[model samples]
Target: MEARSRCRLPCSYYMTCKCCMKRMDGKGKSFIRRTLGSTGFVQAVGTKAGPNGTTLVSTGLSDLDKIIGGGIPLGGIIMIMEDIEAPHHLLLLRYFLAQGVVHGQPLLFASPLTSPKSFLGTLPGLTKGKDSKGNVDLQKSGQSADGLRIAWQYQRYLNEQKALETRRQRQQEIASQSWASGRLHASSLSPNLSSSVTSGSLEYTGTFDLRKSMDQAMLNAVNTVCFSLQGETDMAPLHGQCAAFVTTHSRSVQEVPNVGRIAMQSIYAPQSMHLFSEWKMLSFLAWLKGIIRTANVVGLVTFPASLLKPSVLVRLQHLADILLSVEAVSDDHKEMEAMLTDYQDISGLLHVHKLASINTQVPSFPEASTYSIKVSRRKEVVLEHLHLAPVDVYGKGSGNAGAAQVLCSTPANAPSSLDF
Candidate 1:
C-alpha cells in the first residue's frame, strides 16, 4: 500500500496550510471554494446554490431532475418518508436503484425486508439488451472458412469461441470500473452538448436485471453487504457494524481508478420494529451526516414516517440534507385532482418538505409548486410540476389560447403576458 501524504491544513476545512507557510488569501480561498463547491462540497454556502456548488447526479428521471433543479446533488442525504402506505413508494425505490445500476454506480443495499440480490431479480432488463451504464456485446456468427475444405466448419466454430472469450475479457475490464458511471464518459460524443444528446435527454434506454451477477471486474470495484436483522435488540453491535461498513467502503474508494470519487449511499428499509430503536437509529443517522459531509457520500433511506414518533422524524428531518415523502392517492382522487389541475394521471403526491442550503431553514426548490409523479414503460419516472387540465370542449376555452384585441392591449412585439 502506498503511504498517503498528510497535509497540515485541509482546503475543505478552510484551515491554514502548514506546508505553504502562508495563509490562503481571499482570492485563493475563493478559487478553492469554487473548485470544491462545483465538485459537490458537502457544506452549504448560501440560499441559491447548495452550501457549495452541487455535483448533480441523475435521479434517472429527467422530469424529476428538472423539478429538483437538476437531479439529486451528490453528498446529499435524502429520506423518503411516507405518511401512508403506497405502491408508488416501491416504484420510486426501484427507479432509484435501477438508475444507479444503469449508470454503473456502486450500490450498497442495507435492508431487512428486501435482500439486494432478490430485489435486483425483480428489476426489468435494459431495453436494448444492454446495460446503459456499461456495454453488452452482441454475438455474431463467424464467416465460413474455405467452404471447400472439410475442416472449414470446425475452424469457424473455433474462431467464434475465440471472439466470445475476448468479449468476456473486455466485459470484465468494464465491470472492474464499477463506480465509474457513464455520466463521466457519455459526453465523449461531442463538446457542443446542448445541440446534441444530453445524457439526461430521452434517448436509448434498457432494463437491467439486478438479480443477475454483475461483471466480476465490476463486482471487485465495489463492496455490497446486507445486514439481516438477527432479531437481537442490542443496538451497539449493529450500529458499529453498519458504521464500519460505511467507513471501510469510503476508505477503499481511494484505491479505485475513477474520474471522481463515487458518492456512497447506504439504503436502509427496516422491515419490522425489531430491526432498530429510535434513539440508536437517530444516532446512526447522525453519524451518517458526518460521513456524508466529510466523505462526500450520499445517504438514502425509506422510512415509514407515520409509524415513527414525531420527535424522531423531526430530528431526522433536521439531520438529513434533503427530505421527500410520497402522498398516496387513489385513481378517483387522481382524476379529481387532474380535473381541477393539470395533474393528469397523478400517481401520488411528492412533498419536498426540506431542501438543505436553499434558504437553509425552509423548503425552497419550488414554493407552493404542486408536484406529482408518473412512470412510463421505459422507466421514465417523472416528477413534474402539477397542473390542472380543465375540460373545455368545443373550443370554448382552450388551455393553450390567444386573447382577443383588448382596449389597452400592447402590439404583437410588445410584452403582453404581464405589465410593469
Candidate 2:
C-alpha cells in the first residue's frame, strides 16, 4: 500500500491524507468550498473544439452536460430509461463509450441490465468482431465503419474471455474474503464455496463488478452503463402512495450525507413497477436531482406521460433539462402534452427553444446519431416571467440564430454577470 501524506488542515486539525484527502491552499486553510465549487468550474470550460469525430454527442438532453461539460465527467452517474424498451438510452451510452474508447477515456456501467456482448456489440466503434483465424480484426462491412470499428466476432470473443477471467479472479477474492476471518467452520463455508465454484464455472465474460469496474474503467477507454428500472409494481403504478411506501421500506438502506466518492442513490424503482400521479413529474424531478447529486451519475429516467396534465408535462420538461419524449414517435403523443412550442426571437435571431413541430421523425447519422441540446445559464426575460435558453441548435457560427450564439438582450441600467 502507498504511504499517505499528512497535512496541517484548518482549525489546527492534523489529519492523515490517506482516508480523508484534503485540498489546502497556500495559506493552509481548508479549500472545501473551492473544491466543491470546482465541479461548476470544470463544467463551464466546455470540451475543446476539434474534429467532429472527437466530440461525443448525446440524445436530446439540453441541460445535462452543462453540469459536467459536453461529455460525461470522470466517475459521473448516467441513467438509462428502459420503460419503452426503445434502447435509446443504451444506444446513446454506447456511442459515448465508443467515443471514449477511441479517445482512450474509460467508461463504466454500474448495473447488470446491459449485456456487454449483445448491447455493446452493436456499436460500430467499440464493437469487435472476429476473422476466420480467430484474430482481432476490424469490420469493413459498410461506409459507416469508416475504418474505425473492430467488427470481428473472434476478436470480440477474445476480449470477452479476457474480461471474464479478470472478473472471475476478482470475484474469487471477494467471495473468499470470509476465509480471512477464520470464524466459519469448513462445513459452514460449504454453501459459500459451492456458490463461488458455480459462479466461477459460468465464465464471467463481461465486467461484473458494477461499482469497482466502473471506477477503474473511467480511468481508461472502458465505458460502463448500469441497468436499473424506474417504476414500481404494474397494478398500482408508482403513485404518491407507492412512492411513500417505497420510501418507508427503503429508509434503512438510504443514508444522509453520502460519501462523495461512491455513486450510490437513495431512491430506485424496479422495472416490475408502474408509476401513477398527476404530480408525477414534480416527484420524478426532485428524485432525479437527489439521484444526480447523490449517485454522482448521469441517468435516464422513464415514466408514462399519457395520464399527466399539461402543467405536469411542463414541470417535467423543466425538471429534466434534456427531455427525450419517446411518446412523440411512439404514437402516444396524442394523449401526452404538446412537446413542440412556438418559436421566439432573441436579439434579432430566431430562437427555437420551444418548437411546435420541428419534425416528428428521428434524425439519421452515419453510424448512430445522438442529439445534444447545450443549455445556457438561466437568463431573465422582459415583459414576462424569466425563461432559460436552450442549447445552440445551429452550429456555433457567426450570425447563427440559435439560442447559444445570440446574446441576451440587456436592460440599459441592469448590470450583467458578464460585466463583472
Candidate 3:
C-alpha cells in the first residue's frame, strides 16, 4: 500500500504497519521513536527547566515589568492591584507561593488588599483543611495542598540536616579513600550542586506585633511589604487624616533621636484606596520615604492610576526601586494593541514557564513561553514598563497628561540620593 493510504487506515492497519516497520528497522521500542528523533520526544513529554538565577517572572505585561523587572524576584515583591481585592490577584499570589515551594524558598506576602482567605482560595494545587465530616481539607490532604506553608516551616530543619549529613559524608568519603603515599583515588566523591542551591534564598520575615510598635529590627526582616488602602477621596479627608499620617510620622524619620531604636512607620495608600489631593498624596509618599532608613524592608504603597497628578507622581517615583502600574484589560482597539505589545515584551523578560493569554483574541507573541488570554471576566493588566522613559511620561515636557505613571526613576529612590 502507498504511504499515505497506509497512514489513512484504522488502528489495525497502523499497528500492523508499526510492527512491520519496527521489524525491518530492527528497533526495539516503536517505529515512531526511530522516525521522529529526540525533539519529538521532548515535545511529547513536556518537561522544561525551572528559571535560573534570581529571575523576575512578569505577569506577561511589558509595562508592568518595566518598573519591577518582569514580575518581582522569587523571594521579592509581587505588587497587587487592589480593587476590592479580587480573586484573580489572589491567584497570582498563590502562583508566587507555588514557585517558592517548588524551588524550596520562603515567600513573604504582606497586603492590606485582601483577607488571607481570598489568598488561600487561589493557591495552585492547594486547598484548605477539611472538617470532621469529610469537607475540602486544607492542612493535610496527603497532597501538595499545604506545600507553601509546610515548605516555609520545614525549610530550616531541612537545611540544618542537609548540612550535617553533607559534612559527615565528606569526612567518611575522605576516610574511605586509602592514600597510596598520600595519593587519593582517581574517582573521588563530589556532591552535585547548582549555583542557586549554593547561594540560597533570603529569609526575611514580617511578623506583626500589635504591642511592640513598628521598629527597625522588624522592618529589617521584611524584604517587601505592601500597604494597600482605598483611594479617590474628597479634599478635606485627604488633607486631614493623610496629612496627619505624614506630618506626625514622616517628619519623625527626618529627626535624629538618641534612643534605643528608631521607629519606622509604613503608610501605603494606593490610588484605588480613595481620592486624595495631590499635596496630601505627596505628603503620604514623603512620609513613607522618611520611615525607610538604612533598612532592608522594601516598602510598597499602591494608589489608583486615575487620580495621580503627573507632578506629584514624578516626585513619588523617586521613592521606590520598582514601580508597578495596574490596569484592567480593556476592549478598546488602541488600548488592546498597546496591551498586546506590552504583554509580548514582558513575557520575553519574565521567561514564564507556562503562559496562556485568553480573551477576545490572542495577540500572537510566538516567542513567549507564557500564555496570554483575552477573557471577559475582569483580568488585571500589570506592567513594570522597563523601557518607558519616565521623562517622557512624567517629566517637564509632558504637561501633566491624564496618562498615569506606573513606575518612576530608580535613581530617585536610591539611598544615597534620598533626602532625609
Top candidate, metric TM-score? 1
How close to the true structure is residue 276 of candidate 2, measured as C-alpha lDDT? 37
Residue 202 of model 1 has an lDDT of 23
Model 3 per-residue lDDT tens digits across residues 357-399 = 2111333232322233222222323323234323433435432
Off by over 4 Å in 2: 1-69, 72-90, 96-124, 127-285, 302-309, 324-420
Give the per-residue lDDT digits (tens) of candidate 2, residues 1-420: 111222222221111111122232123334344433333211100122111212212211222232223433221233332334333334334434433333222233322233333444444321122121222233223324533565565566656766775564454444333322221232233334233222211111111211112222322223233323233332233334323323332323433211111111112233232243434435655664454433323333444344345675556545542343321123332211121121232111111122111112432211111222211221211111123334345644343323221234333355753331
lDDT of 3 at 405: 23
Compute each candidate's TM-score over C-alphas.
0.56, 0.29, 0.30
Estimate the overall C-alpha local distance difference test score of candidate 1.
0.46
Q: What lDDT does the true structure give each of the candidates?
A: 0.46, 0.29, 0.31
- What is the per-residue lDDT of model 1 for residues 1-420, given as tens digits with 9 covering 90 to 100? 011122222232122122111122233343244454333322211001233455444454445555565556565676777545675556556655555544444555555453445654454433333333333233221233334443755876766767776675454334323212232344232223222322222221223343343333323333345454435465665566556645543524634311112222222334444556677777767876666554434456767777667787788778766676777666654334434463445567677666655324444554533467765443445666656554556643432322112112333366754341
Best by lDDT: 1
* Model 2: residue 420 alpha-carbon error in angstroms: 34
